[model samples]
Target: MSASPGAYRAPGAGLRALQLLGIVWTLPNTLVGCVLGVAGLAAGAHMHLRVRDLAIVFHRWPWGPGGALTLGNVILHTGDTLDSACMTYAHRAGHGEEAPIVLADHERAHVYQYMVLGPLFLPLYLLCGGVSVRNRFERAADRYACEGRSWWPW
Candidate 1:
């Protein structure tokens, strides 16, 4: 899952900060699979209504073997944060437009969203309780990025 355009921070609680290189959310992660789920939520992490409102705060990659942290993070939820805290996926090539640029687009959007709507509408674009990972919001982001940019990974 790579970062797309329409994805926004989800609402929930206790955001878990994650790293893409070492903490890859993958299969073979069974009963011992971090319990609460994989890579999204971590200890001492909580969504700040203020922070989440100000930023999408995506932290978890919640998808596939080689999860796109930048793309995937936008769809993750922890109470109110989109993710514990935004982090990039490990595979640079998978990131499509070079990791840094991909990250810049994805993370910068959080800032833009904050400025445009003041984080009040974060959940309006998110899929809560009713769905799991890779729901409407993520799909929307994919659709958005699929515009003219061939570099985006759906």
Candidate 2:
């Protein structure tokens, strides 16, 4: 079952076990995100735990495209705040204006993707077309952000 956008469901014991497995599976990518996040921290970024997503977020990251990037369970946000607000870039004229895609929701989808793909997510993301609307991963993430469901690329 899928939760509403920005809503979080508490995990039961079985789900917790699965979450643990995902954490281990995505450890490599998580480590890479951590290294970058720590560097950002050293550069004056602030760190916060997003309890709902079970992810680490670095706000005011000194370097980035002025939006956000998700690597494993870590999200590096260029802005001072990361919330359920729709991202400027994700907004388009005459498209889903009533229910714009939320930035945190989108990145959370990437976190889920990382949990499933682990080390392969980055390579496959590039192979599918990096950071473009045409990319399957991006599409899936957008869908998840907009509809709050179906984050899987397949």
Give the per-residue lDDT digits (tens) of candidate 1, residues 27-126: 1221222333334445433322223323223333344443322222232333333323232332232543422222333433433332333333245435
Model number with the top TM-score: 2
RMSD of each: 14.3, 2.4
TM-score for predicted model 2 compared with the true structure: 0.89
Highest-scoring model, lDDT: 2
lDDT of 2 by residue, 41-134 (tens): 8889999999777689999999966888998899989987767576432344343344566788889889989998899999999999898766
Clashes of 2: 0
TM-scores, one per candidate: 0.24, 0.89
- Model 2 C-alpha lDDT versus the unseen true structure: 0.83
